[model samples]
Target: MTAGFEAIEYSSRDGIAVVRLNRPAQRNALDLTMRGEIGRAVEAIRDDASIRVLLLIGSGGSFCAGGDLKALTERERGALANRDRIRRLHLWFSELLNLEKPVVAAVDGPAFGAGLNLALAADFVLASPRARFCAVFARIGLVPDLGGFFLLPRIVGLQKARELIFTARVVGAEEAQRLGIVTEIHSEETLEPAAMAWCRRLLEAPTGTIGMAKNILNQSFNLDQRALAELEAYAQAVAMETADHRTRVGDFLAKKPLRYDWEALGRAEDGQ
Candidate 1:
């Protein structure tokens, strides 16, 4: 299914939902229309169980340059209105954070300001070697919005996060990988195929179990040990009740070939 959106393109094939940021001429800048389209597209993805994975990418060479500066400057709004606008963005950003299925960001070229935060929301970020990232909000005299404040510190350490934000430092894909920002770096030509292959590999596993675990892990830093233990118990109970769990267990007991043997799969893929 392909949804012809104005600022964004949404399509699904082979259980993968690809959300492409359009408007390459503007470097896929996030304008009001783009924001609204993204929210609607994500809502559609949330309601569709057939879409097992979400891949966010940019249409042109640049991923996203940032907000539409001209639009932002021309728009006149009071403090309350601006506050409301930010809150609306938070709602959709939170939706991405709480999404059950895996979200992969295939970032090529530059992902600056809010764009970087958008990529940070993904479960995995596969960046091209030419990918450039920056918290460019500082240069524009704006603090990081779009949940960048919340997401950055957790991925990179507090000190590193501060340096990136304070300095508005730009890092290439290799350095981003060193800082745990980019999960993997591929050549620009190979990035799309690599990301799709990774998604297919993920499709081999029990998605329900993985989604639940991701939910729990996302809250790990915020929850105390006791609270975490309680959540662990609840999550495990819910997982154990699933037929996928039971079937996998039965297969193990019967010495049958397992479907989600990640290590075995890795070895096979490596021709080991």
Candidate 2:
């Protein structure tokens, strides 16, 4: 419903809401306008219950180049407004973190600084082989934003996260996989199909149930034992109310195999 962005485009197919960072010429840098557009799209998703999943990608050759340095320089003169601006940027990812449905990121060229943190905001990341990530905040004399500190350490271990953040080295797709930064990696040309496949996989499940699961998992990294148990109980209690889950549970109790076809995820299968 928010239509201000020729910068960020939002579209819905089935239950998946695809949010594209469209400023390729600047590598989708997080300027104030771009950041505000992202926030609006997130708010729109929160307002609409029909959307169940989100796929994030960039339009140009690279995913993003992080905060706009030119803007940063201007902000250094008055810094307070800049700090608030940075906080506002996280407001978008905060929505992502709190979304009730799955959020997937498809990485192709590069995800850097705040860009890297943006990818971390998602529940899943499917990367192209050419995809690369870097913790470039150090290079710019800044710290990671958008919950990087909380999410990165949990995903790749504390030591590895420190190493990457300190060194600011480029982590290629395979190496990123080794460190568990990406769920899977395919060819650059195949990223779109792979991402769509992932979105459709979620579509096959019960929408409300899937949304609850995503909500639980989004906070899974930081939950205490009692908290996690309570979250599980809460999800199970709510899931019992869904029609699909009711039928699925009955079938499951009857010892029937759950039927699923996940191969429709390939580019060739999708008519690539």
Estimate, for each residue in 171-240, the C-alpha lDDT of model 1 and write its tens digit.
9999999999999998999998878867776777788878888888889999999999999999899999
List candidate 1 stretches off by more than 4 Å: 263-272
Q: How accurate locally, in lDDT, is each candidate? A: 0.89, 0.81
Model 2 reaches what TM-score against the true structure? 0.88
TM-score of each: 0.95, 0.88
Best by TM-score: 1
Candidate 1 Cα RMSD after full superposition onto the native fold (Å) = 1.6
Number of colliding residue pairs in each model:
0, 0
lDDT minimum window of 10 residues, candidate 2: 259-268
Cα TM-score of candidate 1: 0.95
For candidate 1, which ten residues in a row score worst on lDDT? 262-271
